[model samples]
Structures are given as C-alpha cells and as structure tokens.
Target: MFFKRGMLVTQAILLNMVQLLTVLLLAPLVKGWINRSNALFQSRRGPSVWQPYYDIFKLLRKDSVIPEQASWIFTFAPYIYFTVPLVVALLIPVLTTFPLFMAFMGDMLGGGFILSLGGFFLVLAALDTGSAFCGLGSSRARFVSFMAEPVLMLVFFTVSLVAQSTIPYIVNQAFAGPALILAPSHILVVLAFFLVVLAEIGRIPVDNPATHQEPSMIDEGRTMEHSGRHLGLLRWGADMKLFVLLTIWLNVLVTPWGLVGSAAPLAVALAITALLGKMAVAAFLIAFIEGCFAKLRLLRIAEYLGAAFVISLLAVITYTMGI
Candidate 1:
C-alpha cells in the first residue's frame, strides 16, 4: 500500500510539471496567433505567427539596460511578475480537471490574490523606475484594476454560490452539466466575466496592447523602461497571464467539457488537444472584436467596468430568484 501511494504521488508530480511546461511553451503561440488574426482583419499582412517566440528568443540573447535611478525592485520585478502568473497557471484547470500536485494551494479567491500580487509588484516596479511613462502607465493600470477587481470577485462569488466551493476544478465540474449552462445566473456571470476578460487582457475598448503612445498605453507603459531579457520575461509573463485567464474563461466558464478526469495518458493528450482548439477559437473571436471596436477613452473605462459590475450583481440576483 505504501508503494502504491508513492507511485501515485510521483504521477501527480509528473502531471503538474507537464501542465506547467505546456502553459509556458504555448502562451507565446497564443499571443502570436492573436496578432496574426488582428493583422488579417485589417487586410495587412502581419508578421509571422511565430513572431512572439522569435521575439522572446531574441530578447533572451540580448542585454537588459537598467535606469541608474532604478532600485532592486526594478531588477527583481520581472522575476516576480513572471512567477505570479506561473502560480496562477498551476492553480487553474488548464489541461485537466483533476487536481494536480498544487491542487490544494487555494481556490478561485486564492488565484485572484496571486494575480493581484503580480499586478501590485508591477506597479511598484514601475514606480521604482521613476520614468514618466512608467508612472503614467502604472497609475492608469491601478485605476482600471480598482474598478475591475471588485466585479471579478463578485463574478467568482456568484459561481461559488452555485458550485458551493471556491475551488476552480470543482467549479468547472459543477457547471459542466447542461442544466447549469442554460441557467440565467450562469449566463449572466459568463457575460460579466467576458467583459472582465476584455478589460483584464487589455483588449479593444479597454486598452490597446499594440499601441505605444503615452496617452493610449496601460500594460505596455509599465514595461517601457525594460529591455532585453527583463522585457522578455515581462512579455512572456503577460502572455502566460493572458493564456491562463483565457483558459479559465473557455474551459471553466464556457464549455468545461473536454478536460480530462482520469490519469490515463490518452485522456490527458486528448484533453490538451481540445484545450488548444478552444483557445484558437477564443483568439479568433478576440481578434474580430478588436478589429470591430475602437478604444474607449480612459475616463469612459469606468462606465464600461461599472456595466460589468451591474451585470454581475444581476447574476447573483438571478441565482437567488431562481431565474
């Protein structure tokens, strides 16, 4: 019995490593595909779909330049920024619904806190640099985050109300049934979460990832001073963040159908493939929306987020009323 338990632990460790590596490697590919889709939407031939991977490679080989005024926070921020999303990736149901090694780390609330930690460090890193652009970007990011996080928590709460657990895998399993999928509360929460995704990922009508202008930047602004390997880590971390969030949106909230429930090799492989296909569909839809909508003014962003909050509240009300 002891030997059997040891083997089970080993298998769990291996599965966790596999899930981590898959997210790290595939994150850039998702970003590249989105950029390519955006380019196609504009009738202009964009850079290669593999451009993000190439960019990361090039940055890795180059040297990072630090501002003389920067402190240790600036130097260490990239690692912190990069590591936080990795933690989040592990917590989420990426390749399987079965809990891996770190499955007990926390639930949906813990995942949100981890993400917030990364964002907080990023803001501190920007402030440490004392660059005008970085400061401006940090302020804007904080403002948006202030309005967005509450709605996000409310959305999570609504899901927890139905699932009766804050754990993501349990939440996914709970909502996987056809009955929950068609519920009015579930539909409202999904819509609210979708809006949150737009704001969180810096997509259209929220913030533009493609723009570098001082007036229009948010996430990019925080990294304006970073270059070479530091920039690579930050950008890769951003990609990972995007991938993790999108996986949650698609696999947990929307479909929740293809995730593997067993430890069988074939089941795991098929689950990964299903996740990739779903991600591709999501990337295309995001690109289409980006092409169709213009960026909202910074002040107007509050209204956008406010609408999301209202929708989330309605979701809770719908659940309570059995609507």
Candidate 2:
C-alpha cells in the first residue's frame, strides 16, 4: 500500500510539472496570436506569431543594464513577477480536471493575493528607480489597482456564493453543469472578470502595450528601466500572467468542458488542443474589440472599472435572489 501511495504521489508531481511547463512555454504564443490578430484587423502585416519567442531568446542572450541608483528591489522584481504566474498555475485547473500536486495548496483568493504581491514588488522597484516616468507609471498602476480590487473582491464573493467555495477547481466543477453555465449571475461575473483582466493586463481601452509614448504608458512605464534578461523575464512573466488569467476565464468561468479528467497522454494532448482553439477564438474577439474601441482617457478608467464592480455587485444580489 505504501508503494502504491508513493506512485500516486509521483504521478501527481509529474502532472504538476507538466502543467507548469505548459504555462511557461505556451504563454508567449498566446500573446503572439493576439498581436497577429490585432494586426490583421488593422490591415497591417504584423510580426510572426513566433516573434515573442525570438525576442525572449535574444533578450536572454544579452546583458541587463541596471540603473546605478537602483536598489536590490530593481533586480529582484523580475524574478518575482516571472514566478508569480507559475505559482498560480499550480492552483488552477489548467489542462486537467483532476487536482495535481499542490493543487489544494491555495484557492482563487490566495492566487489573487500572490499575483498582487508580485505586482507590489514591481511597483516598488519602479518607484525605487527615481525616474519620473517610472514614478508616474507606478502611481497610475496603484490607482488602477485601487479601483480594480473592489471589483475583484465582488467577483470572488459572487463566485463563492454560486460555487460555495473559493477554490478554483471546485468552482470549475460547479459551473460545469448546464444550469449554472446559463445562469444570469455567471454571465455578469464573466463580463466583470473580463473587464478586470483587460485593465490588469494593460490591454486596449485601459493602456496600450504597443505604445511607448511615455505619457500614456501605465504598464510599460513600470518596466521601462529594465533591460536584457530582466526585461525578458518581465515580458515573459506578463505573457504567462495573461495566459493563466485567460485559462481561469476560459476553463473556470467560460467553457469548462475541455479539461481532461485524467493524466493519460492522449487526454492531455486533446486538452491542450482544445485550449489552443479556445485561446484563438479569444484572441480574435479581443482584436475585434480593440479595433472597435479607442483607449479610454486615464481619468475615465475609474468609471470603466466602476462599471465592472457594479455589475459584479448586481450579480451577487441576483444570485442571492436565486436568479
């Protein structure tokens, strides 16, 4: 019996490792797809979908140029940023429905706190540089976070109300049924969460990732001083952050049907394929939205996230009312 238990533990560990690698590797590809799709919408030929991979490898080969006045936080933030998504990956149901090793270590709320901790480090590092733009970006980011936190709290509260738990795996399972999938509360929460994702990831209508105009840089500004491997790590970490957030959006809140039930090789392969398809569809939708909408003025961002918070609040109310 002990030997059998050891084998099970080994299998879980292997599956967890596979899931972590999947997030780290495939993240850039998803970002590339979004960029390519966005370019196609604008009638311009964009960089290849493999461009992010090339960029990361090239940056990794170079040397990082750190600011002289910068403290240890400047050099430390990148590692934390890069590792945050991987930590969250182990907590979420990525390719499989079955919980892998460390799967129960933390739930969605814990994952959110971990993500926030990484962002906090980056913000501190940005402030530490003493650059005006970095300071501006850090302040703006903090303001956005200030507004986003309430919506996120509401989102979690509503999900917990529906699922009776904050655990992502359990939440996914709860939403898999047809009734919950079609519930009004679920729809509202999804919309709210998507808005929060857009704002958090520095996407269109919040801040433009492609723009380096300085005045309008929220996310980019925080990392502008980073070079070489440090920049590569931050860039890769951003992609992984996007990937993991989308996975939660897709697998937990949107379409929870494609997750594999076991660790079988074929099952994992099929699950990955299904994930790619979902991500492609998501990329196209995001591109279309970005094309249709202009970036909101910084002042208007509060209202933008405020709407999300309100929607999530209404969701909670409706759920309690059995709607």
Candidate 3:
C-alpha cells in the first residue's frame, strides 16, 4: 500500500523528466538506427551506429559562419526552432501520466490545437532568415502545416467524440472499461492517428526527412543556413521529435489501460514494450515508405495531405456514430 502511494503524481513528475531526457538523449541513437535499417534494406555496409553522435559532437565544436544578409534573427531562429518543439513535445504524456507539464494538455484536443502554435512559429522563423532557400522552404513548411494540421485536429476529435471528452487520460480510462480493442471506433482512431504521425514526422508521401533535393526540399531547405552548434541542436531536436511523436502515437493505445491499480506493473511494462514495438514497426514502415516512393511535385503536396484530412474526417465520423 505504501509503495503504491509512493508512485503517485510525484513519481509521475520524476518519470516525466526521465522520459523527456530519454527523448532528448536517445534521438541520435534513433536516427542512427533508422539509417542502419535503411542501409540493410539497400544491402550497403552502412555507417556506424554511433556516427550521429560523432557528427553532432563535431558540429558542436565547430565555429559558425553567419551570412552577410542574415539578421540576429537568423542566429536566434535555431534556438527558437529547437526550443519550441521541445516545449510542445515536453507537454505530451509518456510512460504514463507522468510529465513535467502534463497539466498543459488541459485535455487532448486542447493540447493538440496548442501544439500547432510551436510549428507556426518555427516556420515563421524559417522565413525570417531571408535566404532564398530558407524563404522557399519556410513558405513550403507553412503550406504543409496548413494542409496537415486540420487532419491532425480532426483525428484527435475522433478520440474526443468517442470518450465524450478530449482529455487523453480520460480517453484512456473510457476505453479501458470494457470491450476495448474490439471497438471499431478505436481502430479508426488508430488509423487516423497513424496518418498524423506521418504528417508530423514529415515522413514518406508527406515530406522526406532524408533528402535535400531541388524544388521538393522543404524543411531541409530552410535549415540549410544553420550550422555549428545551432545545426547540431536542430538535428538533435528533430531526432527527439521522432521520439516524442512516437510516444504520442503509442499513447493512443497504451493509455487506455491506465497506469495504476492491480494492473500497474504489468501496465507499465507492457506500455513500454508496446511503445518499443510500435516504434520498431513504425521505423520499418517509414523506411518501406521512403524506399518505395520517389518525390512528388511541390504543388501536389496539398492533395497528399488532403487525403489524410479526409481519413481523419472518417475517423471523426466513425467515433460519432460509434460504429
């Protein structure tokens, strides 16, 4: 009984901190893992697993060069670019309801909507750099955000409609009650959530995180100007973002069981396993996607994200009708 109480909200806070560090720290490892995976798929010898860490460290130690046209905003932009995602992602629940700012969510729908503010600022900062590439990429990023964000909100709305509230914790509870996974509504929500994962991660068919090709290169284009420690942080932040994004995606299913009561230990272990398992599958799926497809025309971006929006709408409808 004493042990149980010890693991209350306080533990949640501690655990949240740990989880955040895991995201921040393990991001490079995750990137390396993806690269390793991609190489194997292509039958190449591949880079070392620790290569990303080496690159980040080397970058951090290098001197930065500023462009003549660049304002202080150009230098300042990287910090903002890196920090906002960290803050927004820090707001997400992980391992359980344990987060430094779990309260920020207020509820799932509200949190989902609020997180976009960070994306908005990052894109704006990209444009502030004033480089031709930065301008083009930032404009593209904003357009992509515009196209993808509605679908994201609509997908979250699916959960809200089902639980009759948008609180992720509450939604988890509602689904935990009975006849959980068997619920078709949950399946639809998961499918919708998967698309949000693709959109937010800028994965295949949405945006390629790997390439910096002409015309189609969006995020990388804006980021081209960032170098030295600034670039290091941005790359690290992107890796951390994948972790955070994966956590949110996993929460859609794992939270349903809640994280206390007789099932606490099992729930915790299983949730971790589920997260790792999901991330494993997610990594492969993303690679498969990237490997299978070529880049699309810049103008066609809207149609791709629009399809996701339509699916999210379907998810919302599925929840509302409770089919």
193-302: candidate 2 lDDT, tens digit per residue: 99999998889989888899999999999998999999999999999999998999999999988999988888998998999999999888888889999989999999
lDDT of candidate 1?
0.90
- How much is the lDDT of residue 239 in candidate 1? 90
Q: In model 1, which residue pairs have backbone atoms overlapping below 3 Å?
A: none
lDDT head-to-head 1 vs 3, winner: 1
Off by over 4 Å in 1: none
Using TM-score as the measure, the top candidate is 2
Per-model TM-score, in order, reads 0.98, 0.98, 0.84
Error of 1 at 50 (Å): 1.1
Model 1 error, position 117 (Å): 1.1
The models' CA-based lDDT, in order, is: 0.90, 0.92, 0.67
Residues 1-323, candidate 3, lDDT per residue (tens digit)? 88888766566666566556656666687677777777777788789877889998898898777777767776776666566555655555555653344644566655555556545655665666677787888788777777776877787777677777665655655666766665776776677677667767677677777777747777677677778987887777677667766666666454444343322556666655655666666677667777787656777777877777777777667656756
lDDT of 1 by residue, 1-323 (tens): 99999989988887888788888998999999899999999998999989999999999899999999999999898999899888988888888887776867888878888987888988999999899999999999999988999999999999999888878888898888887888889989999998998898788889999887987899889999999999999889989989988988998899988988887888888988898899899999999999999999999999999999999999999899877
Cα-based lDDT at residue 132, candidate 1: 91
Better of 1 and 2 by TM-score: 2
Task: Return the candidate ranking by lDDT, descending.
Answer: 2, 1, 3
**RMSD to truth, every model:** 1.0, 0.8, 3.6
